[model samples]
Target: MDWAEVGTLVALLAAGALLSGFLAGLLGIGGGAVTVPVLFQVLTTLDVAAETRMQIAIGTSLALIIPTSIRSLRAHLAKGAVDTVLLRQWIVTVPLGAMLGGAVANLLPSDVLEAIFAAIALVLGLRMLIGKLPFLLGRDLPGRVGRTVAGLVIGGLSAIMGIGGGVLNNTFMTLYGRTMHQAVATSAGVGVLIAVPGVVPFVVGGWGRPDLPPFSLGNVSLAALAILIPLSMPTVKLGATLAHRLTRRQLEIGFGLFLLTVSVRFIASAL
Candidate 1:
């Protein structure tokens, strides 16, 4: 990369680090919702291929979230908020989903992928903003069916949107009667699953596409990953540690508002 490109990457990473850490600390989301758009802008500025930009953006964002998720996971674990049993079950499902989703992400037209993601963000956003999350609706069961359903959709979308699927997972759990702390902690674990498989297939599928950009590895963007991964880790750690301490009602209010905003922005951009 050129000096200008290096400088821009550095700036984005810096901003991403701060924003990521704050979001992690506040929301336990590991910054994918934020990362996608930011990476989208950076990939565009880098003259990444029009055809593969979203794929690269999503893949690179998941790649970057690797360290961040580890950091946050440790923090949540330290606070005794993590649900290992649930995480163990989900970790099994998500990676499988990630690989399948990655393949599907590559096969689908980019427009279709973007519209579906935007729709998810819009619906989730509107629900949160209205303070009417179905999770808080006081419903109860073992959630087997719900978990399976969430896994499929979250896994698919995680690959297509280039997220770790924690946002969707957390939302599902929260609505399922899991407390916010448990949901956030469990979501961190979900990130680890998606990041690994998500990056691999994206790279595999997008690798030789003639229309792709210079440094892309399949659907993943190496340049952005090089800068973003290291910078996002500590912030995620800080965020998870803080999540264990934040009040539930306050966290709910804050996370809801943030998702609401990000959701709208994503929908607007995709539209």
Candidate 2:
């Protein structure tokens, strides 16, 4: 690519990163939802092969999530909104699940992965949109065994979908009666758990592949990470601050709308 073209791409990515960072803090999502799609488009522009493009995007997103989640978690921690007990319960199991997910993602087709992301997002979006009547499993969170299983599922799916586990974790927490603020805060911690271990399998899976783009480490693109990380970090605090300011119902509506939009976009891409 020419210098002008590269500059344009960087500009586009920078914009996405800023938004992703804000969403990370605001929603505790670690910004993978935005990062993955933006990276996929960038890869497409670089003429990356369709088969590997999604994996690269997902891998890069996970890598970016590590720092983004940390920043977001720290911001939420200051507010005393995080649910430490729940985070502790899932720390071990979630990482294991993320590793398993990364391995599974390597075997799956890109379209299939997109479909999974879309389907889950659609369901969660619809659930959140039905604001007045939440679909609850019980008045309290599940017991240890149940929480472990939930953690596993959250980790695995988030890994595959290139998310920070916030979407799934938030849903899980809220279904059991936790407040939206608490769910968002705790999900930031979950993102840290999922992303730290999730990135390894992707690195191993895509290592030295012929189809990869330049400056790649397995399925991750160093260029994209370099551009995204710095731009995304500062905005996380801004988003976290906004998250605290918003009302619970407002937060739920916003989250629902964002998920639904993402779902539609991915579904179309998959098709």
Clashes of each: 5, 0
RMSD (CA, angstroms), candidate 1: 3.1
Q: Which regions of candidate 1 are displaced past 4 Å?
A: 1-9, 131-146, 248-271
Cα lDDT of candidate 1 equals 0.70
lDDT of 2 by residue, 1-271 (tens): 7999988889989998998899899988977877887888889899999999889999999999999999999999999999999888887999999999999998899888878878887887887688644378889999999999999999999999889988788878888988889999999999999999999988999998999888999998898999999999989999999999966577668768987998899887766
Predictions in order: lDDT: 0.70, 0.89
lDDT of 1 by residue, 128-150 (tens): 45542643644542466656666
Q: Provide the TM-score for each candidate, comma-separated.
A: 0.84, 0.93
Show the lowest summed lDDT stretch of 10 residues, model 1. Answer: 132-141
Write down the TM-score for model 2: 0.93
Judged by lDDT, which candidate is best? 2
